[model samples]
Target: MMDKMILKRLMNDHKNIAILLDVLAKKNHKLSEGEAVNFALIRDVVEYMQVYAEHSHHPLEDITYDYFVKKFSSPCNQQLHEEHSSLAESSGALMYSLNLILSDVVISREKLISDLKAYVEMQKAHMQYEESELFPLFAKQLETDDWDKIKLQCEQRLVDDPLFSDTGDNIFEDLKEHIEAG
Candidate 1:
């Protein structure tokens, strides 16, 4: 039951992430076209993603992947775990770049646009890997007890996806409204 619930949330979270990615891609295009884009909004997206990924999504995945590896006597993909930290760093750098511009620091629009494109692509590819590889592996190999264990482990570290939750972190209210309004 918990496994299924976590799986459902993970899939839904990916969809939400995709929407943010599209927003970034579109904003990047606008920036490239010499249009003024909202730097704070871009920063909001990155900040919220880092918060959710670090606090909720990645930990849930770690529990699930840990159980899978334990049961099957096979190693989880190194990238699956390493990508969390790597993406965090990447998102942090992107936010830093946005912060610099927001502070009136001169930055190259083309460089920022390129970074945004790369960031969005990286996120999409990461989601695709989990959906295509790890998810199916769990469905096929993990036992009922494994699911229950993974579920219990998840409960121990549960954190709501702030952007989607009614009682989410207060900092994300504006970003939530923007996503809902979009």
Candidate 2:
């Protein structure tokens, strides 16, 4: 079975991503008003989503889903895999738009907001699906060996030098603290 601790940690990470999504939404709103885009902040959010959310979260699910496909070969695993594929594509598109925004390419503010909103919506829905369906299946049906493989893959995929660290010394901490204190 998947480790309960790992699962919980993953959920916490998802929560953090949700929080970041809210912040990004606000930032997108400001940008649409022709306010400063805050490229550094945007970069941080993009890096976090790409590294922790996509790189870590998706690989873990991929491993878990692979095991499920091997054992079940049913519609459940197939459906989840299809959703993952769609999520991955959306994420890639979001990243591409973010890059353009950062580079000061003349992207329409409306289009940027729309794309960003789409990414956030898709991710939130994807998480809900996993928590409600895939996670329970994993808790009930996954073997210890299956979990071990997941852990190994997750460890291997972890970025040793993340583009932006969450160290207390960073500006992100200050931003988060300011948001919390308000």
Candidate 3:
């Protein structure tokens, strides 16, 4: 039983990630003239996806999925788990390709774009699945104690990467400011 607060926080983080994905997708499509597909910004996006998004966020979902699987023998848990695996695999492959391109190896920009597109699409679909199917189920099923446990696990497992340490601070501050302004 995941905490409602934890689920809410996870959903908020997912929204932030979706925004970043949109920004990356737009920026990627508008690659500067003569700029490699694996530009610095592209690397940053891939790093965030690999470290912050996949590494941190997915583990929480994995725990939630585990609980659901144990609680219900329905097909939903199995399908969601499969979707999670697919998203992780696709995102990891895309990150690897981006790293290769960043390693000074000449690669086709088209291929990089293709991989990125696929990754983004997969992520978008996965997010929708979580929001539409998984989140509501969690909210209904998880007790406060379950949520507290999940929160503790999330905090303990949090990765302290440069992206999270540096960029996250400013981004979240800005978000706070924006919310306050409104």
Candidate 4:
């Protein structure tokens, strides 16, 4: 299953996003309990989603999804693509709220937590849909040539994950420690 590696990488990316979502949820919990929420950390998480995940992960999947739709006439592509598009808008809202908090504005904690929860849940559900439905369908439908095209597209657009890269900044180090300590 040569195409499986690509799917696996996508799955790992999903897992990584889940890691960030977990931290976000925890922060929300802390906020609910009257503890200070780290708006900077929340901003970083949203930034990672915007910069790395959106730039690299979604484009790769869009290429693959487009291929699948064209080659196999699947109807699943549109919903997944729409979800991908909505991610940016939803994340932007989350970032907007976080920015308000960061700037010492008096945004409601309830609204911030609500937005974070909604964003995290939406991301998790989208990843699960791809993993459960789309990946298997692709494995059944795609040929070597199709996968080759995908590989080439991925190579052409490389976006290194700043938090997970060897050359990554230590900005996420505290987040990583929190993840490990949990």
Query: Which candidate number maximizes lDDT?
Result: 1
* Model 4 C-alpha lDDT per residue in residues 57-154, reported as the tens digit of each score: 88888888887787777665478789989998999898888888788888888888788888988998998898888888878878777787777767
lDDT of each: 0.83, 0.68, 0.68, 0.81
Q: Comparing 3 and 4 by lDDT, which wins?
A: 4
Give the range of the ten consecutive residues with the poorest summed lDDT in model 2: 159-168
Worst 10 residues of 1 by lDDT: 1-10
Error of 1 at 98 (Å): 1.3
Better of 1 and 4 by lDDT: 1
> Which segments of candidate 1 are over 4 A away from where they belong?
1-3
Candidate RMSDs in order: 1.7, 3.7, 4.9, 2.1
TM-score order of candidates, top first: 1, 4, 3, 2
lDDT per residue (tens digit) for residues 1-182 in model 1: 55477777888888888888888888899998999888898998999888887678888988889878877788556888888877888898899999999999998887898888888888988999999998887777876767777788888667777777677468877777777788
Please, what's the RMSD in Å of model 3?
Answer: 4.9
Q: Write model 3 residue lDDT over 1-182, tens digit each, in one string.
A: 54476676678778777766775677567653445342655666666676676677787787776766666664554666687678778777776776776787877777777777777788888899889988888888878877777677677655544333444555344433433454
TM-score of model 4 vs. true structure: 0.89
If both were scored by TM-score, which would come out higher, candidate 2 or candidate 4? 4
lDDT score of residue 175 within candidate 2: 49
lDDT of 2 by residue, 39-120 (tens): 6666567666766667776776776677677777755546666776786787677678777877878777787778777877
